[model samples]
Target: MARIITLTVNPAIDKSTTVAGIGPNTKLRCTQPTFDAGGGGINVSRAIKKLGGTSLCSYFSGGPSGAYLKQLLDEKDIEQSITPIKGFTRENLAVTDTSTNQQYRFGMPGPPIQEAEWQNALKQLELQLNKGDYLVASGKLPPNIPDDFYVKISRIAENKEALFILDTSGEALIKAAKSRVYMLKPNLAELGALCGVTSITDLDLKSLAQEFLENNDCQILVVSLGPKGALLVTKNEMVQVPAPVVHQKSTIGAGDSMVAGMVMSLIWGKSLVDMVRYGVACGTAATMHHGTQLCIKEDADKLYEWIKQQAPILETN
Candidate 1:
């Protein structure tokens, strides 16, 4: 089997804590806090591991926090390749209010990357990639990195005959879309940003998704709609996969888990429709857990069956 590889240029230590409730100027007693290695691609790799799959996760790590991130990944038994740099990685905080069941996230900007360090990371990625492998480049581009970084990675994938998957937003996504990619996963907001749409209701989502596939070199476009489910758009067809209704604990890693599920299914040569079905299942399962814990294999299996039973018949325009 071809190995799965995930690249995250900007990574962080995700710390999540729970309190009874949240209010301004209120002294809240936080419950036990949880910390995990995080970034879009890292979360996907973690989710893949939770789903009984293996993946190689590569990212930019720097300073003391980078050491901790590597240690955390090591504890999880997730293989990784780190491109060490000078500045420390950023930390993200997530506060979950138990009383109202609301989750608030505070994210910080990552360290700036030197040109040499950025180029070195790209060289490492190119050297490691092989034919038939799956390469997922996700997350925001840190300052000092070129906007066309993903575009360069896509070209490397093309040269190696690898399957390239992109999960990003704005200019980075637009630039990467110019290359031939195996798949692109974008949340509703990101999709709207890509299509220059201010608001995307259910009515116009399918059309917008089709427009992307037609206009870009993307083979498949996956648009996630949180609890509403997701739409899978290909050149010839489209499918609507509904998320299983569940009491959500936190939605932090849901989208990343969805990408993991989809890529895992694709690596196994599952049909595109089945890939979306399992992706929704994984995403829904992730929301049932608190903190950075991703979708478990058992939950994904159960939800996969449920999603298949409730799958919507999509009408393509």
Candidate 2:
């Protein structure tokens, strides 16, 4: 079996709570908070396990919060590989307003990483990756980390002959686009930025996607369209994967869940179309729950069937 490894440079301990209502400058009571292991790659690994798949979750661990994060994942039997650091890992919070069904999220900055710390992380990741492996690296760059951090990982993947799936934004996205990437999961805004445009309408969505694939070495480009599903673009094929609507509670971790589903589909030797459809299914399923909870297997499986029945808007060049 080809190994599946996920690397989250900036990991977190996610805390979620529910309050009766939210108001400005007023005291409100909240329910007991629930804590979970978080960050992009961590969530992907967690979702994969939820779907009865396994992945090695690798991340930076620092301070007591990082320890707690590891403990949370350990409880779920999600295998983890840690890279010790001097700075504390971040802790993010989400508070749900019961009255309005609105979720407010607060994100903290990750601790600044020293040059040696990040360099060591790269060395460890390169050592762990092997040919035919699937390496999923997700989340934003932290303080003191270079924008080209992922570019280095891309090179490592290229040398190792591993498939690199990247999910990130900002300058990191801009630089990594020029590197060798097997797949990219960027939101519509990020995709537009890659195309060097400020806006993209439905009329030109396919064109921009084509342009991205043509101008870069990316084999697969998955532009997440939120509730509308995602657009999957390859060298010769482009299709809009439709998502089934559901009662949405929270949108956290939806993208990571989507990536996890797609990776699992690949592991199962499914076709490209099936892989993206299952990804859309998992993304939609993530919205049906509160907090940072990802897609459950039952929900994702049911949604996958619904997505398969719906006709995909497609084209083949």
Candidate 3:
């Protein structure tokens, strides 16, 4: 078993294509579509593989779409464990308008998971996790599942003495943060939501991040700042990782790529500052491509070196 295991409860087959122009009606013909296996944890697994690391991806599945998702992972040589379900997995679409260089994304709500199916997923996770392992539970909970689902997973991780890394939103994220989690990667807006504030200014961001770490069982909080950069906050210190400017292609799977970089860095025993630097590098590299391509190892490595030379850690007071 790989030391890292990822769980994506709401997985999807991501289909992307391009159109010359996107206008209302008038028969807009799209180019040939490309499909990729996606979901928060699955994308993390894919990015890890791209970074020359290995992890087991566990997710729910059913129907032809689910089988296709597994096939996509197999093609990428990513290891996976599937929990069969009754509902077919959902598919999301992304159409890029070539003329305007604008990408329009359409996300679908995943199929509702039955009680037994979700419980079975938990049982599978319990079987896979071990001491000192990293369990990354990401993506949203499917409809009809309880909001406290990740909370239960957190408990399992605690019992196994595994580190739980959570990347999610809304109620699922809110409830799970109260449990024993090792880290959280929330975007600026999601961090604002977690802090119960409608807005978070630059001055208050670090303070709020510090407060969350102090209060919650979560040991590390990484607030992704998109084009600007990311903030890595712990109980002891805070470091701001600046992102290098690059030709933007697509933002899909960027966050998962960032998480993958940081986890791989941790496994390699890099410093926390270097971990966030590599994470920002992977995320920026992911945007230098289209669709769900994620980060390439060469690009990420170059960016990591560039960031290290130009960006320095600012020790927060």
Backbone clash numbers for all candidates listed: 0, 0, 0
Q: Which stretches of candidate 3 lie over 4 Å from their true place?
A: none
lDDT tens per residue, model 1, 1-317:
69899999999999999989888897989988899999999999999999888999999999889999999999999999999889899899999888988898998889999998989988998899999999998799988899999999999999999999989987898778888898999999989888888889988888889988889888888899899888889998888888888988989889999999999898778898899999999999999998989898899999999988874777665
Question: Which tens-of-lDDT digit does each residue in 1-317 have in candidate 3?
Answer: 33999999999999999999998969989999999999999999999999999999999999999999999999999989999999999999999999999999999999999999999999999998999999998798889989999999999999999999999999998899889999999998889888999989998998899888988999889999999879999888799989999999999999999999999999999999999999999999999999999999999999999999975768774
Query: Which 10 consecutive residues of model 2 have the lowest summed lDDT?
Result: 308-317
Better of 1 and 2 by TM-score: 2
Give candidate 2 regions above 4 Å deviation: none
lDDT of 2: 0.93
Clashes counted in candidate 3 amount to 0
Question: What lDDT score belongs to each candidate, Candidate 1 first?
Answer: 0.90, 0.93, 0.93
**lDDT for position 19 in model 1:** 89
